[model samples]
Target: MAIRGYHAHLYFDPHEVGHARAVAEAAQAAFGCPVGHFHTAPVGPHPRGSVQLSLRPEQFAQFAAWASEGREGLTVFAHGLSGDDLADHTQYVIWFGTSEPLDLSIFG
Candidate 1:
């Protein structure tokens, strides 16, 4: 390992709270790391909307189907996200694990 390490952050706009929250909960239970934060708010002047799974600057790639900044490994922690079917708000997924993540531009 190098003297320094890197991490990533991701924002997702799910359409369902239960779905999104499930993903977050699953991640927390699976990973030894903390879940960081989770919350909900309104969008476009409407009421009763929620966007879950907000990652800190430090849980993004664990659920990324693709890679961004790390070497390919058989130890991938993806392919296990749950309840992730919400709408268009913004939930940042911050990953601080040892695996490097793919760049954000790829998502664009």
Candidate 2:
């Protein structure tokens, strides 16, 4: 089966929080979707400052394409929300740039 929706985690360095925020905001504008909190510290198992956006499957391909335009050096970690957190974050995810270490045990 195809994916239902996705959660895109936009990770950034400490000094680039603003840039990340702008990227998230631009994504919201470009896609007309909701952008989640801009986190300075690790949220749950995430290893860096991150912002999240939930995208329906219909929106995924376009969003991924737009993101590949190199939205100012942000590392995008996107995964499907298939009711299986572990697999979603691990096996079914797409990484645009370096992947960060996540404390996946939280999903247990």
Candidate 3:
């Protein structure tokens, strides 16, 4: 099934912090993906975290571009979460791709 969009919790290194935020604001431009939700951290070790985001339908091509020219980052696995998990600060990206029926409840 072709994915309609994507929901993710993209993380970043200190240098990629501001640039990662820029990805949300300029999704179409930066990643050829649409941006949504975009809830930022209030106060904590995750001061640079953004747990809400939605990418566009053209994920393959967009990801291709990213793979070719994007910077490097880390990804946290399913068991790498801490505390609320939603706001865990792992200094890396903790996002997943979705197909058709996206269940935001899983993350909440």
Candidate 4:
């Protein structure tokens, strides 16, 4: 199936929220993507604090490249939006740093 878009969740610890915010804001300012709320606690399946950056498919490569270097030690959980949350989080994902275990039970 064709990807609809993408969501890149930048995960950070409570102490690293400031770093996460800077990365998210830089991404938004550079790519003009929509940055979601900075959650200081784990929400949904995310294992830690996170901020989501919604990006178009066309923006993925550039964003991913930029994030790989610009993330400043943050763990970025990025995936394709293909209308299947389970598969999107598992099969169609990439990571910039150490990957975290998501609560996939929420999908089932």
Candidate 5:
């Protein structure tokens, strides 16, 4: 299935919230993608506090590269939005740092 878009979740702890906001703001400024709320608590299947960046398919490569170098010490969980939540979170995912275990049971 063709990916409709992408979601990159920047995971952070309370101590790193400011850094995460800076990273997210910088990405929004640079890439013109919409940045979601700075979630201090886990939302959906995310395992930690996270900020979500929504990107178009055309923006994926550049954003991914930029994020790789710009994420500081945060773990980035990126996945393609392909309709099927399970496949999107599993098969179509990419990680920019140490991967974290997502609560995939939320998808079921």
Candidate 6:
């Protein structure tokens, strides 16, 4: 079954901090949703500096479109919150650039 919510991880390198912020801000501005705090380094199991946005299913398609086109050179890790963490991060993900290895232990 499809999940009712989604989480998008916006990854950036330290040098690209400003670009990362721009993307997150644009997402908040466009979607009118709360974006997570920006991290300059990997927080938890993330492999790079990142920010996150959580959106309802209603907002997923719109956000996905903007994310897919607006990330510039940054990478995005998007997945559903369908209760199965492993499948959610792997099978159910959409990538805007190269996929990064996540600390999946956090999910289980």
Cα lDDT computed for each candidate against the true fold: 0.33, 0.87, 0.40, 0.93, 0.93, 0.86
- Give the residue spans of candidate 4 off by over 4 A: none
Q: After superposition, how far is residue 48 of candidate 1 from its true place, in Å?
A: 13
What tens-digit string does per-residue lDDT give for candidate 6 at 1-108?
779789888998899889988888888889886789889898876899989889888998998889778887789998898898788887888888898888878866
Choose 5 or 6, whichever is better by lDDT.
5
Clash counts for the predictions, in order: 20, 0, 1, 0, 0, 0
User: Residue 64, candidate 6: how far off, in angstroms?
Assistant: 1.7
> Positional deviation of 77 in candidate 3, in angstroms?
8.9
Question: Between which residue pairs do clashes occur in model 4?
Answer: none
Return the TM-score for each candidate structure: 0.30, 0.92, 0.38, 0.97, 0.97, 0.87
Q: Report model 1's TM-score to 2 decimal places.
A: 0.30
Greater lDDT among 1 and 4 belongs to: 4
Better of 1 and 2 by TM-score: 2
lDDT of 2 by residue, 1-108 (tens): 456899999998788898998888899999987998888988887899888999998999999999887466788999998887788888889988888899898988
lDDT of 1 by residue, 29-98 (tens): 6444344343344332223232223333224445343333331221222221223312111222233234
User: Residue 65 error for model 5, in Å?
Assistant: 1.2
Residue-by-residue lDDT tens digits, candidate 3, 4-107: 44444454445555666655455456655554443344222223434444454456445535533342343211112233444332222233322122223445
Off by over 4 Å in 5: none
**lDDT score, residue 11, model 2?**
93
Least lDDT summed over 10 consecutive residues: which range in candidate 1? 1-10
Report model 2's TM-score to 2 decimal places.
0.92
Deviation (Å) of 23 in candidate 3:
3.7
For model 3, what is the error of residue 100's alpha carbon versus the real structure, in angstroms, after optimal superposition?
23
Model 2 is weakest, by summed lDDT over 10 consecutive residues, at 66-75
TM-score head-to-head 1 vs 3, winner: 3
